[model samples]
Target: MAGPGWAPPRLDGFILTERLGSGTYATVYKAYGKKDTREVVAVKCVSKKSLNKASVENLLTEIEILKAIRHPHIVELKDFQWDNDNIYLIMEFCAGGDLSRFIRTRRILPEKVARIFLQQLASALQFLNGRNISHLDLKPQNILLSSLEKPHLKLAEALFGQPPFASKSFTELEEKIRSNRVIELPTRPQLSRNCRDLLQRLLERDPDKRISFKDFFGHPFVDLEHMPSGRSLEQATALVVEAVKKDQEGNFSAALSLYCKALDYFVPALHYEVDARRKEAIKAKVGQYVSRAEELKALVNSSNRALLQQGTCARDLLKEMARDKPRLIAALEVASMAMAKEEEGQDDGDALDLYQQSLGELLLLLAAEPTGRRRELLHAEIQTLMGRAEYLKEQIKMKETRWEAESMDKDGLSESVRSSCTLQ
Candidate 1:
């Protein structure tokens, strides 16, 4: 992380042997831990430069969520470390890639096979929701296949595909494939139609309305309480806290799982303080990088609308760009090129088009209407945008209305009352 306040060199303790994958803000590395066993683990390395305050807070929230969840379907966090510039999260290495890759390679899996995985996933969800934690991002990439091999043996010879063995009966082929592959097929459990329906409810998108333990696990699909575990919840929390404390002391990215452990033990106020301090530290550090950008002015102008929409932390980052206001203004000048003709009062087709596009960006920022000290400045910007959008709307009659209220006027006519883009 090349920020101004604090930028640390990457850690040298772990030997990075292979690239695992890249994520939105971090890269995954397959590395060997420096401990006695020299165990291989996947490290998720996030640069302080990439993490905004919101992202930092989200990371902590995720840690707290994971700390309380004890399920076979979920991946486990092993450790965390922070260097001068980067934070490294040591986690369970799932040799089998995420569910998305598996689904992509195999296309539609057999209903029975999919059901088994779904059952496991539902069990995990059931456990989390029991504790009022929701997995906001629930997609195939986050849903990992078991590191443990499945037990099912191959039942029959390949039908459309060529045989692995040149000479073997279908029955003998089944026996050979079963012996060769560690996996074995299990007898598919018969699920009632209602149970299948219940599974869909558990996977609902709306976090608030999603099914809970009371829904699917009024009678659970599986017995989570009786599931095997190497350590009790208390023991796990202790280990996690120890790891977190070590990472915090070493100035490494503290393990999210450990934060969750600490949260489990501490009061809510304490947890909030710990999280807030981390976020503040991240913001101060990131502001330094933003300040040093060569295109600081242009970057600020271009990012203004987005910053307004995202609010608080983004606004804070933008405030730091004042150090290089000249550069930022230069960048904004480049950004305004497309609107140059419109600004000059030209009403040509190109000018109209530019005006409309610029108005959309401006209106989007206004629509968010963020608060704090920047509220008045943001309001002025939004009003300027709305004035432009209103002009374009008159010129083009851009047939725009949505179920959600347009602007903040609520008492006016809605779609049911009239049909000609009426404001309410």
Candidate 2:
């Protein structure tokens, strides 16, 4: 049904059922094609009377941009038409409403779920960035979900509504915006350290100090390497081909790295694959890859132990050479502690943190060190620490995946038991 005193537009080849939403200049409605297929879509109808010169230009620019781009995470602009009274934009219909509604209903999302959404958003942003475009009014409301059961994000136009801020007056909102006050995140729903770090960087008031798109894309939390996308399968296949080549060459270490990278994409590819037969095939391939990777992991671990033993003298020499540089020595000590922690096999998370800290310090020192033996040693140390950190991340993800699968199985069994008891 339309709003009071508002009649739905009569567009050819379609029948508007009900008003879905409306903004200042336009109204969106649920509609279906008049043909037998009866394909559904959302039609955004903008009145000519409401358009000022600036607004008209903005509309034209939006249409041009939407028409020119096509991405998996972006809502598709099917077509457009205009009559004397209104212009219509036919868009892909999303059944799951918007993220704002999804979040509100759930109260607070689990960190895993939030991370998935963030990755999807980042993927969309990465695409726009490649084309030198920006979404000026990005918000939860402007992000649509494909379906409620298994939501896939779709970036869409903003629907005018009450802002998230709780200022009582326009003057108050203006003061809040102008003020140099720090934005504090809520503590009620405790967030993970990576999530908190990303949020803080994103909310940084100074544009110069804020995280850049490149850094954001590469962030550990974003983990674009494992982000599900249309290209996930293609990327996984290419990496696997190289991984197999390296494996056959007996380059176990390099093969292990490539296999890990491929698995990152393969996991996402499995998630993206819809057809049951294809999904099962991917699962089988993944199992084979995983088995080979485990073998390589053991071989790599043995090689690493040998390398560590051989490097002991070199490490001692490097420390003696860097005695004049106390900060560099301290960073080296931290890196050693990270290695010891990893060897102990007690806390990979803590080991990863120490590795990150040492790497951060060593990278800075290396940048300042002149090209020499000391610089070479420092760069090698950084690379080793980075590799360890990446390995730990993969281990963590595998554990998390196993736990989630077990949890789902338990949930299904419990539901089945409940249903059987009810029937009895």
Candidates' C-alpha lDDT: 0.45, 0.75
Candidate 2: residue pairs that collide: none
Cα lDDT tens digits, model 2, 1-424, are 7558877889999999899888899999999999999999999999999999999999999999999988767888989999999999999888778877766665555565556566777877889999999989887778887666565432111111223244899999888767798877766466667877887787677999999999999988888777766688899899999999999999998887887777777666656666668766876787787778778888887888787778778788889999999999999999899899988989888898998999899888988999999888877767777888888776665445434423432332111110000000
Question: Which 10-residue window of candidate 1 scores lowest in summed lDDT?
Answer: 415-424
Number of clashing residue pairs, candidate 1: 17
Per-residue lDDT tens digits of candidate 1, residues 2-89? 2366322345566675666777788887778677888777788888889999999987776666555545556777667887777787
Error of 1 at 163 (Å): 32
Per-prediction TM-score, please? Answer: 0.38, 0.80
Q: Highest TM-score among the candidates is held by which one?
A: 2
Each candidate: RMSD: 27.9, 6.8
Candidate 2: stretches off by over 4 Å: 2-6, 154-181, 186-193, 241-250, 276-281, 284-288, 366-424
Supply the TM-score for candidate 1.
Answer: 0.38
